[model samples]
Target chain A: MGDTFRDEELLADVICRLIGDVRHVAVGAQSPIPATAALLAQARGGGSPYVSLLGSRAHTFFTDGARELFDCAGQGRVDVFFLSGGQIDSEGNINLVSVGDYAHPKARFPGSFGSAYLYYVVPKVILFRTEHSRRTLVPKVDFVSAPGGSPGNVYRSGGPIGLVTNRCLFDFDRARRRFRLASVHPGHGVAEVIDNTGFDFDRPTHVPVTPAPSAETLALLRTTVAPMLAEVYPEFVKRVFNVPAPSP
Target chain B: MPLIAQSLDEALAPIAGGRLLAVPRESSGVAMAATRALIRRGIKRLHLVTLPTSSLQADLLIGAGCIETLETSAVSLGEFGPAPRFVAAILSGAIKMRDATCPALHAQLQAAEKGVPFMPLRGLLGSDVLAHRPDWKTIDNPFGNNDPIVLLPALTPDVALFHAPMADRAGNVFIGTQRELVVMAHAAQRTIVTVEKIHDGDLLRDPRLAAGTLAGFYVEAIAVSPRGAWPLPLPDHYGIDAAHMAEYARLAATPEGFAQYLDRYVYEKRAA
Candidate 1:
């Protein structure tokens, strides 16, 4: 486990564990990490589900779960959706629209493809970020691109159930409706999670390790997802996950 | 040959066979009303552009006839299977699939909008799609012996129906960019424009707003409807009606249920 817990590895570990042992999970397009994780889990024979999303149709995965996004509310099949944040409010509201104004936006972030509907509708939503700091963790989202926390809690008015950063895994408390430090990736600690947050949280004494993929999972991830990414996003895959042999 | 302006019965007068008519996804207000009016007049064929989120406005479109066709890409279905009629079309080979993943299809549409005869694109090189879809073909570079470029012939429709924010008496209109209405305008032989309100000016207001986007010269008849693409989505107007769309999901899930819903909303109802 000493491959220097890279960002892609961290994402894969967090996503695989998040799904636990479900048979089906759907993601969106433009999400590279989650796409890899689902493929990795399925390929590794870890009792994990297939990762079906846009563009990953019949080509990437053994089975396609792309249809889950459209009927997320009506059919209710998808287990997770990956999202990002430009601005987030205290109530778990997110805004991917613009940092400044709606009409004449300053930084007009790509408007949510289906993030708004998916965030509110999907049963399980995950907010992921590479950097974990006060700047990234805002007091509130300027736009409600996707809900991190919705009223009535998930299942009724659903929002993000989990957040995974390079540092740790964060899960919102169902009753209190505030993000509580759930676990940290291996080699990381509670202090790291707390230091990165903008808001206060009831810090757990021992923030557990966001589990890593088993040896079998590692092999499958390398073989299945790596090959798929190499086939599809060849350049991005090499640049992001390029891990040279560890120096002495 | 009647020039029906802002009227459903007038626009769809030719195709009142209760078959579905293809329309863009983001139409609203008067455009939606006119579509509804056409449905009431017994034009059953309704083809909606399916996106990821539900095209809730399609509920109104459903009432038009029997929702005989639902044409869209894989991304549009979200979680469920393809719409029933669309599925039937695929199996029966009546409605040809333009596999959205194929860049050739987009280029073809783009070429049509640009008033071109054909368009060249990539990604269909190693695929078996072109061979199956007789409409598409891959030809050698007429210039040199380098490589082949896949081409999609321009697709010109019989009529293009669009909902705009405003239009004048002459049918010159302005549609905010949300719907990509310009593509619809160019790809059709005849264009039907529905306006929310008829402004006094030429409807462009200023050349700055015009931007060569909406070509009034392309439009055929101008219809006026207040809420054409209702409960669906608009450019700068409103978001989709999730609740209404959910009801449609319920209706669309089953064959009998969808037909019954159509009867209550479309068949028995009088023109608005």
Candidate 2:
């Protein structure tokens, strides 16, 4: 693989791999990268995995409205879902609500959407945060929109499987309630990740660099996935893939 | 009796200051034009509910001080960024917030649609959203030992409001594939709709359109407001106005800027 792909492409490639061979992948709003990955995965798998972009009419199949997504997840229909947060702790707890006190937050993020429920139902929840820094990877999230792990008695079929950031990927251990350094993205190192991280995590002594997207994968992303993504994330596609915005 | 209103203001007349108003998510045809009208009217103390989630509609209402309390899953501007006005209001504690998850809000309204006292839902265990909502109670599954589930009280809003592509003279709204509006209409005491145009024939008269049409019986009022979901997409009919939305996100970032936005768009209404 050459150094031709952009960071967004790299992140999308990583998320596609994280998505694995799933039956249904639901990408939420404000998530261009995950939506790209889901489309890419769908294209690559000969359309085996159904991709549902929440806000797109062309991408989604549901006619039952917004509740259908959650209802389907509850019935164990959705296999992979993506969630991002304002802050994510080592324990995989995500905070999409606020950064400070519940009553008077210093910085209030968009209120929690489906994470509270989808995080519990979707079997593979891949956490993605484009920004990798101490502020974002906090020691403890100010609010837990959804816990990374529930108690033994809780009826949880899904939780965080791994986290993909701009710098690296961290695989979550649900039973141990911790994260292990999986692999660092190209141009980033363990030292850089450690320096920027606020919470502690276990990392292998020899952390390999994340592989870049294959030329074939890049071609598929640019030619196929880029057009499909334009339906939902036109601006992102215009910026990352240089796809021209359709005439209004 | 004719249910059509002569004007947007008259259509929104039933939406009193303190009444609970239910609205659909952005993709389901948000009543952006009506929202501006509400702001222009200086409607106050509205308890706004977003069926699953919201974006510009909620932010604009919150910024205009029309909202007293907001009950929703999330409020964002999609690709544009975090809703500046909504974030500021939350940080300042200007309006009461009842933070809820997407499914919970849907279930609450579904309970009302079914005329049930409450609806039992899975998930939301060990979440702060559930913790903060004391009104939401957890009861053990009597059918199973040691299994507890959360029961959400039925949420019957005073009015349900939205925009759509078309409605018939008889008040039958053609909501297309956006079925959430149906749930919202079914749960609310009265349904108010704004459409791009009035269809020639009854929406229910067409077999192809009947499945997606909300019966005229549920709709209390209808107003013709072309491009009613402006800046936001109305699915099928129009795409989002990217430049306008980007401009809105930039201009609405500050209080003075937001006021400027209100002056240019809300106060001085654009000629439809």
Candidate 3:
């Protein structure tokens, strides 16, 4: 508690590494972490893995308008995308629709945005949820906004590749249709993750700690990435990084 | 001759009760002032269709008891938290929800725009969303053996209502890069637009803005409402009024609070 915790920056670094060597990563609205990671990747890779942030004029490259983003994804131009939900299960089913019956839900979350389509079209759909607690990571989602994997006969080219939470990271095994615990974050243990997680996942015999962000990465994030993110998510940058809001 | 309304009320009058009214996403110029005007006029029983998603506008309408059936991918006051009124109404079984995905809504509207009966789209094949939607159907591709896909029925709304950055005297509204609005205008039988301001010259005359302009031929009515999308951002023009949105989210959490909010902000308008 002495020094300010850079949890968001650390998570962003982890996400940046997970992005790998992709051509284009398109981040949807309301996803600041993934957007930061995409931008970080761009900065680290010398302008590689183009980032197309929805709802950003400088970041997006769509001339045909909002529909163009969908068209591009349909044509397989978008490689990596981000999706999250109110509840995520062991099998990677996400629920952004409702918490109870479809007719009369006990809790109604914002309806599924593009998960139905993006979860299938984007090659690498990284599911990110900041809170990885029992309530959020459930045994099974009440509503399947999008399934992690589809039957072999079904035409699905995209699904969950990995899930990043505040506690840890889990790599999705498409064939097994289960999440395998990759690593727990610093100051967090496997037991803590297991205790907090509502869903069951396979764990390695010896779990390792998620690597802390390097000094260079932290510096770059504070300087370069923060400003770039400010262009799109000014409030997030201000609240998270203490960056001044850019003048309109 | 285009149908240009003299006032905001006149522009919204054609959107009769229980009409399937299509509106743009929250990011693209939300007609907030027009929305308040609609609420003040007691517009009821609207089948509200948010192109892909919505925020305050949808929640306000739902809270005001104006929406009968809502078809959209999602509706939330982004960053502000969950849409309280939408959640309250849904929990109470007050409104019918035709749950949909983002691309599905856009694809259906495009199908209507192209004058087609239905449009085939990828995905939703294995999702439970398809299971609940009895209206949607899946079929094996006629050309390819054993290839299946989801076909969405065309969504031709009765009226396309939205706010634009500007509109010319000829009724052409300049939407800039928000192209989804163009699709909405084309798919709906009638298009009613509220603009922030009116352009002096014909919008079509400027070749640069022409491509981004929605020609007056598809427009049924237009009204000039400066700061039409107030409390909401107009995409590339201004940012969202976060304080006001936060206040709405806070007030809409409870039914009584929501009514009081409507009373202060919507019902009994104080002198501006």
Candidate 4:
């Protein structure tokens, strides 16, 4: 890989493509990649689909406070949203509550922030976890903050459509209740993903390498997305793009 | 007589010890200066609720031994990193943690606002969050056929304490789109506010600001404390003091360091 862009930029490009032509995209807390993709989509899509980034002073349209995000998703207005877990099972169960037991045992992660609701309401809930290992991607999550799929009678309009990890992308099949290997990132192979992933997933005989970021996408990301992201994630912008945040 | 308190101490006087106090999210005006004041007072055994999530305020209170029980969805330092004191307390079983999902807290608060017994919410049906929460009950939807859903009991806090951009002489606060604060104020028995400044006229008189105004009827007391949400961003007003927060996250990582932090920044006032 040349010094053109980092792995995060490539991942953002894939996410931008996956976001394709959506009316509205919402990026949650602690997600710089998804936020980049959402902004990239907006810049490329001629601002057709709006992007609402949580914790940004200028980007968000909510006048009602934090709960408005929940209210909008509940009303089915939010088209795409991003979520990740400390532990994600093959079944798509996300555990952000804790790593061990409910009462108390081991690790304690940030509690679920609207995942239980957003997973059910948003049309496309993309699961993005940068770390793709057996420890992070387990056979079963110790605590399920939100289940991947629900019973037939359950009124769920949205759920995990795809899982984007450092190694590969896995498309979730709601009916099958399992993830199918979509594509592997560049320089990484099936064997690496297989070695790292704890849970079982279906894959084709020949898996393709995840596409690199296009020249145009890279340009927009560096010129437009980087500056926009500086407000919310200054450290990420500095580390990835080597761009200093604009002075307030 | 005006409801404005002469000093911060008088404003926070109603918060007596061991009461359920509701607060807003971290990004949405967090009342950090007020939190420092509470720490200075050495208030104890308070049940604190961070509407959906919190950052510095929770960490500071927990570090200072002010909070007995913390009811919130998540507590993180945002860009700084995981809340060290919060992590330490949870792991050591130092605080009573009522872990909950974000919407559940909002729904429960909404229930209290509506004076309803409970609110039925989607999700959490097969979740461990539901399993651990004995207060949350799953019942078959009376209207639907064999559809099971979880009902969250109303959590009516005793006091709603938060900071805002501005308040009027009438004591109406302008929260401007942070609707959960409205719900919190309506649900809690008493509402206390610390604002960056107080507007001259009645906030309700201006139609543009009226929708965002919380009437004086709901507000019990008000204190003017500029930069009240320092170290945390007050939406649409100022960005976060990242350096301060980073310093906090660094110093508060250890118990002794946290004590030193309290001594330097919290307990010991700088000479003017």
TM-score of each: 0.49, 0.98, 0.97, 0.97
Clashing pairs in 3: none
> lDDT tens string, model 4, B107-189?
99999999999999887777777777899998899999978888999999999999899998889899987888899999899
Per-residue lDDT of candidate 2, residues A1-248 (tens digit)? 55488999999999999999879999887889999999999999998699899999999999988889999999999999999999999899999999878998899888889999999999999999999999999999999999999888788999999999999999999989899999999899899999999999998989988999999999999999998888788899999999977654
Question: TM-score of chain A for candidate 3?
Answer: 0.96
Q: Which number leads on TM-score?
A: 2
lDDT of 3 by residue, B142-230 (tens): 98878899999999999999989888888899999899999999999999998877899998988999999999999998988877887
| lDDT for each residue of candidate 4 in A1-248, tens digit (9 for 90 to 100) | 34476889989988888887778899998899999999899889887688899888767877776778888888999999999999999899999888776667588887888887789889899999999999999999998888999888787889999999888999999999899999999889999999999999999999998888878788889998899999999888988999986553
Candidate 1 on A1-248: residue-level lDDT in tens? Answer: 43444568668867766766665676664566777776666665544565564443243342212222344433456566677665554456555444554433444333345554456555677777767788767776544554554333123444577777778877766456677778887777777667767776665776667776566566556655676654333334666665321111
Alpha-carbon deviation at B236 in model 3, angstroms: 2.6
The RMSD of every model to the true structure, in order and in angstroms, is 20.4, 1.0, 1.8, 1.7
Tell me how many clashing residue pairs each candidate has: 38, 0, 0, 6
Q: For model 4, name the residue pairs that clash.
A: A63-B177, A64-B177, A64-B178, A64-B179, A65-B177, A65-B178
What is residue A24's positional error in candidate 3, in angstroms?
Answer: 0.9
Q: Each candidate: fraction of true contacts kept?
A: 0.01, 0.83, 0.78, 0.66
**In model 1, how large is the Cα lDDT of residue A147?**
52
Task: List residue ranges in candidate 1 displaced over 4 A.
Answer: A1-248, B1-6, B14-22, B26-31, B44-85, B88-103, B143-145, B269-272
Residue B161, model 4: Cα distance from true site in angstroms: 0.9
Q: What is the C-alpha lDDT of each candidate?
A: 0.54, 0.92, 0.88, 0.88
* Candidate 3 per-residue C-alpha lDDT over A7-72 given as tens digits, one digit per residue, 9 for 90 to 100: 898789888998899999999978999999999999999999888998787887777767787888
